[model samples]
Target: MAYTLHNLPAKLEASKMATLGYARVSTQDQHLTGQLEALKAAGAETIYREKISGARADRPQLAKLMAALQPGDTVIVTKLDRLGRSTRELLDLIQRIGDARASFRSLGDPLWDTSSSQGRLLSTLLAAIAEFERDLIRERTGDGRKRAMADGIKFGRKPKLSDFQRAEAIKRRAAGETLGAIAKSYAVDISTISRLRA
Candidate 1:
C-alpha cells in the first residue's frame, strides 16, 4: 500500500484539541524533557515518558498508551527514531495503529508520521530504506571478513607460549612430569597443556 498518514484514520478528529504524546529514553540518565517539550510544541497533551531501550520490542507504557488510544486521539512523538529505530518495528507499529484506527505524528524526522497521507508514504519508504541499508551493511561486513580470512589475517589473541615452550612441555611430559605440574610451571591452564600434548 502507498503509505500516507492521510490515508490512515485520524484517531482524534480535527475537533479534538488534545494529542497524546509518548517519549522514550533508552537510558535512565537520559532525560525525556526535550522530547516532551517538542511534543508540547506540536500541540500535544498528557505526555507519557519512559526510560527504556527502543531495542526492546515490549514496552509497558507505550503498549498501554496504544491500547488506551481512542479514535479521536492522535499519538505524538518527538522523533520517528524515538518511537523505534528499527525499520521492522516502526512499520509494524504503524500497521498496528492503522488496525487500532489511531493516528501518529513525529516532530523530528520528516518521514515521521502516519497521520497524513504524505507522512505515511514517507514513513513506509523510510522504513524500507532502513531495512535495505542494514542488509547492505551485513553483506559488506561478511564479504570483508571472508576476504580478510582468505588473506591469512589471524583473529583473536596470540598463544601465550611459543613453539619452543610447547616443545619443552612435550619433553617434560615425556620425562614423566605431571600435566598439573607442567601447567603450573608454565602458568597456563591444565587443559592447554593437555591439548598441546595431545
Candidate 2:
C-alpha cells in the first residue's frame, strides 16, 4: 500500500498532525532542490534542509527537526538514506521518533512508514535484528580480547619509562631525591617518579 497522507490512520488525521520534512545533501555542492520540491508537494508544512554528510553524528538541522517534533507529528524524508547513513542509524532515529510520540515516513521507501501496520511490524523486526547483530559483535570482540590476553599480548598504553630508567627512578626516590627533581631529569611527570617501586 502507498502510505500517503490520505491513507494515514484515522487517529492521526483526526489529531491534525503536522507533517515535517527533512532534506539533506552530503556536500555543499550537492543540490537539495529535488528533495525540497517533493517534500513540499507531499504537504510538508515545515522543511528542514542540511548540507552535511549522513555519516556525521552532529546535524544541526536534523537536531532542530527532532526537537520541534510534537505528539502525532510525522517526519517525512525524501529517501531513507537521506535520513541515516546505515540501517542501525535509521532504526535508532525511528525509535527516537517513536519515543517522541511521533511517526516517520520516507517518500522513496514505503516499508519505512510507521503510520502503517505493516511498516511498524517490519521496523520492529529490523530493530531486533540490528540489536542482535550488535550483541554478536560485542561478544566477538570480547572473545578476541580474551584470546589476545592469554597469548600475553598487552593492552593500553605502553610504560613510559624503560626498565633501567624505572630502577634508577626508584633508587633516586629511595635516596631522598625529590619526585620533581627525578621527574625533571627523565623528562617525565612527578606522578610517574612517585609511582616507582623498589
Output the number of the TM-score-best candidate: 2
| lDDT (CA) per prediction | 0.77, 0.88
- The true-versus-predicted C-alpha distance at residue 126 of model 1, in Å, is 2.2
| Best-fitting candidate, scored by lDDT | 2
Task: List RMSD in Å for every model shown.
Answer: 8.4, 5.5
Q: Candidate 1, overall lDDT? A: 0.77
- TM-score, candidate 2, is 0.87
Candidate 1, residues 1-198: lDDT per residue as tens digits? Answer: 011122323664445644778888999999877877787778765667789898887788888777767675778887778876776787777777767778788777656667779887886787788789889999999999999999999777998788999999999999999999999998999998888853
Model 2, 73-164: lDDT tens per residue?
A: 99999999999899998999999999999999999988889989988999999999999999999999999999999999999999999999
TM-score of each: 0.56, 0.87
Candidate 2 ranges with C-alpha deviation above 4 Å: 1-15
